[model samples]
Target chain A: MGPLIPYDIIPFEWSSIIAIIIGLCFGFILEASGFSSSRKLAGVFYGYDFAVFKVFFTAAIVSLIGLLYMDYLGHIDISMLYIHPTYLWGAIIGGAIMGIGFIAGGFCPGTSLSAVAIGKIDAIINVLGIMVGVFIFSELYPLFEPIYNGYFYGNITLEDSLGINPYWFVFILTIVAIIMFAVTDMIRKRVKKVFY
Target chain B: MVNRKLVKFLSLRYKILAFIFIVLAGGLVLLPKHEKQEGISPEKLLANTINPERYISTDALAEKMINQDPSLLLIDVRNESDYKKYTLTNAINIPLKNILDEESEPYLNQDAYDVILFSNDHFHADQAWILCTRLGYKNLHVLNGGINSWYNTIINPKMPTEDMAHTEFELYAFRKAASMYFGVAYPEKVKKATVIKPVTKPSITAAPKKVIVKKKKKKLPIEGGC
Candidate 1:
């Protein structure tokens, strides 16, 4: 039934407004969950705090299971959903850069933005760094174009790539996530806490 | 002593979280596995089936063609051999079998054009329409009565009787003009010579063939990502 704008069930003109509303809610939730604090975010790497891991993993699993249920009940046509195309080398290289940035600066892009909303000076610098990186990438696009566009595996899901049943995949993933959560709690207790 | 230590490690909050996860996993395990459905629900398809708005009449299509409507996209769903034999001006051939192919996606899935599907008759075109509509394509239409109707109405319109309404005569005149516009020859309009040349072969009045060159398929730019 949905992917409403594509189906013309919801007029395309309202898309921008809807996006703004969703973005606002997302930012509000991020700030409320203490994601705006750089120390809490960086603690995941130090084994002192696992809030980031728990929250994001739970969000992923919840959305996955919810979407599956919705599809089964015929509330939405899951096939109509847009999936971001995968670029293999681009993802690997970009992920490495983002991980380094997250460890060093203590904020990812989305959390940095939420921090900036609360007037954090560090977040402002991080945002500026991100813009500079974007500018550099744009300027050197021709040089990076090969890696950026190479090894494109068109939009696909676990079902397509791994040939696994989505239901079983989600169930296994939930169990793994719960085990990880318990393990992280134990690790946090053993590690010396760093006061922010 | 080991059991006490394990119980102490698993706090109340952890126990509750584990319980919730177990329930959710149980639910997921119980869900019946099915193949991914690429089509819309049958009820919605039925609703679209009963709606007559999906069919565009030949006269409306002819008018759109004459006016050079930018949004008009005529898809001849007949096979290549039949398509090459004769087709409407500027109509692209996307055979019924290949309607669901990746190459046909850019043409059928876009909203920029009023994509009209047609065949020799309504059968093949309707099948194409159903396939596309099932995939939730927008701005799609079936050419009512297909090419046979186009031949009867636009190519060789019957003269209306005197008892018929004025609108019928007007429609007939429009059709005759349209037939001429589409390059139909009238044998009766030819002047007779004193010496009649013997007809070698029986005249077969075929519609002028206009082959539309297919454009190279390019991937459509998809929107909506973070």
Candidate 2:
């Protein structure tokens, strides 16, 4: 049942139903984990709390390991998965914009939707702000088209780009993540609590 | 001194996570490294050729020629005698053994042309395809069922049976037009001897071991906004 869509085990007609179920689960999990709290989300930047960093990093690493293990065991064909193509300069610029937005808004796109479900007026405003940003980008698409489309990198994987063995890269990343977790805890203890 | 106290009070969850990471890292280190396979393997190349999309039907080839599709390039992989006796219009003869020769390199490797290789049946065309795939050639396709199929389908087309589908009749009509365009005189009504079997009909056909028939589905809407 793993990678059900790609294997065509789940028919194409079931995609929308599957999507809604997945979205519901995601929103439930996020809300249950206290991610809907803007203060808790923003605490990562200020080093007041490290829950966001710890949870996200753990989730990423766990999924990475799980997928690698599944692929190694031949349960799923990883090559058949659609990888989002990379555009070098476009990625850098887009990431920079996103980072700034994340820090200022205190609610990511997903979390903001969760927040809105709880009737938070601020979350509604945040969602509207995101919509406005999207509208502006679409309107001015021609102007930004060159930058958006430049530096095509053909959906290259991290291992391909860095020229390192995948397992070695995973090992290195796990070590780095552990170090970051330990460091973030230290910073959180040192910083004065904001109690928000 | 403070860091030592914090370490002493480290939570059980953190300890377990740290253990998992360390174990995974150690396991990764111990695993034997194997070089990744770079290009298409012979088995995979053969398997890919089983896909019908890799074959341009003889009728389609005739239609393309009729329309003067500049991108289409036909290569006859039979001997010079067979090629001279009868070959598709504007086809170049490059014998199966000579496919890798220096003179044939440019004809085989161009991106602009949809290079179609053919033989009497699919045998030599498949061999040519295998050679091309192994050597990392792009845009090379086998003419399905090859020249024999070409003659049966285009040089003389058969009218559809009484109970046949409308689409089959439409295809027969198109094949008739193609036959006429290629200057091959075909009968209005096909005799039992002249009637050709469907392309996938097994007795005379050197068919693949497995043929996966993919069902057609309506195109789904583009998914994901964020």
Candidate 3:
């Protein structure tokens, strides 16, 4: 009911304002929880500290729970949100590349931007790398057109592809994440800390 | 002074929290459903095209024509020659070529009419609908199956190509080599819809510009339907 944009229920103008507010909240939360550090973000690969794991898992779980609650409570419709298309080959290849990039640069796009806000030099380099990568992708789009357009399942959401209710999926995913969170906390205690 | 006020505010924290909770609950009650409303429903239609109101069934439009709803405006967004030949009854010819050409503003400005547009296919109608709607025209609608559906439902009413048209068997086809050379689709059992209307041919003032649009609307030779 409450998707402010696209419906034109709320004026199209509120979209940018909402995005800015959401981004600010997101940035503030990440910065508050010490996600601005690259070494901190990189610890998922190195097994030094699992603060990243705890924080990320908690946030994901929180959002999932919140979305489910919102859907149930009828503040927002779950069916309306844009689901990330499952490009099987693209998701596999692109995710692998992003995982590698995450480990190497120690910052994903969101964290990199937040870090840049605070004048972190390494994050600036990481952000530049991301920009260059995006530029290269755009320029080379013609060459990659075959791959990009090869297998389209037509904007299918996870529910459409998997034949499951989104609420149930979110609930199950929440359970799994909670388990993973508990398991990682144990693992984090075991890994010897290297203070950055 | 500020510390005492701050303490008082802190002491009244439950009241503020209760206020927020009540506001959220009130909003949940007040905000309208995003899906049920019209306008392509940019979010949930993408989310679920099965959403009935958001879906513009071309088959349904053909049915509406057969039933003769005079209020429905069918816009032919194909070029002039394509439009001049065999547009449906009461359908307006606003070709895609001159759609944005400023002179065609009256057709685009028909917000009162439930305008369903089409061409050789849905591509042109969809473009027109998208263009008009994106420019803030709410009444402009898409003819989903386009003229192909006009052929299927109004012309012949056959089984669909995708999954065997769920409707009952009402027609068959002439698979002969002679039919192919002529480029006639839905050849048999398809009569001009307006032909049955006993044409004393009173200068059709019902038509806007004295254009004899139905002249090219003739049926081919006999066969069953598909």
Poorest lDDT segment (10 consecutive residues) of candidate 3 chain A: A166-175
Chain B alone, TM-score, model 3: 0.47
Residue range A35-95, candidate 2, lDDT tens digits: 9988999999999988988999888888777777776665665676778999999999999
Q: Model 1 chain A, poorest ten-residue lDDT window?
A: A71-80
Tell the DockQ for candidate 1: 0.52
> Judged by DockQ, which candidate is best?
1
Report lDDT per candidate.
Answer: 0.86, 0.81, 0.66
Better of 2 and 3 by TM-score: 2
How would you class the docking of model 2? Answer: acceptable
DockQ of each: 0.52, 0.39, 0.02
User: Could you tell me which residue pairs clash in candidate 2?
Assistant: none
What does DockQ come to for candidate 2? 0.39
For residues A1-196, write the lDDT of model 3, one tens digit per residue: 6654644678988878988999999998888888999998998877777777866765665676566567765666666676766556777678898999999999988999999999999999999999999999999999877777666566786677689955556556655655665577677789887888
CAPRI quality of model 1: medium
Q: Fnat of the models, one by one?
A: 0.67, 0.57, 0.00
List where candidate 3 sits over 4 angstroms from the true fold: B1-226
Q: TM-score, chain B only, every model? A: 0.74, 0.63, 0.47
Chain A TM-scores, candidates in order = 0.97, 0.95, 0.87
Which parts of model 1 are misplaced by more than 4 Å? Answer: A1-32, A116-124, A138-142, B1-10, B33-132, B137-157, B162-226
Minimum summed lDDT over a 10-residue window in model 2 chain B is located at: B214-223
